[model samples]
Target: MLFHFMSPLALSNSYFLAFRPREEKSQPRLSTPRFSSQRTLFLTENNQKKLPFFQARHHWMEDYKYLFKVVLVGNAGVGKTCLVRKFTQGIFPPGQSATIGVDFMIKTVKVGNDKIKLQIWDTAGQERFRSITQSYYRSAHAIVLVYDVSCQPSFDCLPEWLGEIESYANRRVLKILVGNKVDKGDEREVPERIGRDFSDVNHFDYFLETSALDATNVDQLFEQVATRLTNDMKITDERVHQYRADATNSSSNQGGPIKLIDRAQTQLNSCCSRQ
Candidate 1:
């Protein structure tokens, strides 16, 4: 008998969501709702091919309604990676390592009738990687600032993080504040009320406390991101439509002679039809 075991981190990275909107159904649906299973072969340290079990929805090469970039930023060891792993893979990475410069993963979710492909960028929280991380802020549609509830220093650094966000991120980017590790009741140094107040005072669009280890609010957090972005995009598209309509009306009105001739032709056609 042969036995093989995989670590949590390896398992988390092995599978990723590749959701495609169903062609036949009016509503978006995944082929494997529970867990889309996919297999990948990789060369092991011993130069032998190994297959790891992972769950993700397999989709065709091209199909998506919208693509969004979501970036995560906070101090080191703030459970940013763990939060992402928990949300993306439904696993708590006990031995998660700090991100180097940056890392990314793709997860497709259905927001209303729109199939949104979220490109989640997990940046290194270390000061040395500040330059690298700051560059990603401008392109992100949503920015999630994460802090550990049990760590006072992390909470205290929110202002500094906000400063960086203001300096680097888009002026209209959706900002969210997340206090992670709320499961640590006795270890918690920052109260929920304080976190909420800070978020309100700092003008965050929304605030929530989460525990990646226990999978509390992890799914809700990402869902909120997708929902908010989808709504915002819809509003923007409506505004653009209104602007175009106004522009077309203005252009038509400016065609004074052409409009009069067209109106005369319209009246002549109506007269002929009446006859």
Candidate 2:
């Protein structure tokens, strides 16, 4: 099934060659590699970095050490898809169509030495898709609530979104309030101070303004998501480790059946002496 789906793109050149007639001199074929062109550095024991040319292969499969689910919920036209596209593909999708139900994308980023994969779910903001989108809230590690800076109604409807999040999401889920399209300076409706106040009063974990069009703080936004979640997960893991260690120490210190027998014998001896 997987091969069937991938065969078209894999055999496209062969299909084109079969249709063309044989010629005396065939033009040189130009092939473009699918992977990134960036060079990977491999350090040696001498602390020297090895840079090899034409090293297009990536070690992403082995480097991906963590996976996190992040969901975006906001009004329909608030640029959620555009933000995800800009972050994942580095392109501003002008005139992007409204999302129907839900869309998802995966992008890997480095948080310290650990490679963190962010599974971003872009939920449709339409009223009809509320049922479908709400189902995703419970499984998300972080929920980003986005609003348009130029739309007052979008900002005003934040309470409704928050209510839905509270009802459907986990209690410990990280919540972030994002004011998007901040580049529209003249047409801005929600002031940054007001947005901050709203986020503070509502207990959002963090707040920021971003522009998917200008690529302003777009990278920072996702980086913050990955960093915050990575730190939080690390802290949680440490606490669990400490708890397990404490539990083990406690169990080892507690006397087993032998101590219970010794206590019972001591009580019998005391009764016999009193008699």
Instruction: List TM-score per model, in order.
Output: 0.72, 0.71
Q: What tens-digit string does per-residue lDDT give for candidate 2 at 1-275?
A: 00001011221221111111113122122222121111221121112333233221233223455556788999999999999999999999888998888777768899999778776888889999898888777657789999999999999999999999999876767899999999999999999999999999999988999999999999999999888877765554444445445556666787532222453333322211111
lDDT of 1 by residue, 1-275 (tens): 11121111121110212233456353223232121122321112112423232212223213465556688999999999888888888888788888888776667788988778776878889999888788777656789999999999999999999999999876667899999999999999999999999999988988999999999999899999888877765554444445445656767888732333454333322211111
RMSD values, in order shown: 13.4, 18.7
- How many times do residue backbones clash in model 2? 0
lDDT of 1 at 197: 99
Per-residue error (Å), model 2, residue 49: 25
What's the residue-level lDDT of 250 in candidate 1? 68
Highest TM-score scorer:
1
- Runs of candidate 2 with Cα error greater than 4 angstroms are 1-62, 255-275
lDDT of each: 0.69, 0.69
Give the range of the ten consecutive residues with the poorest summed lDDT in model 2: 1-10
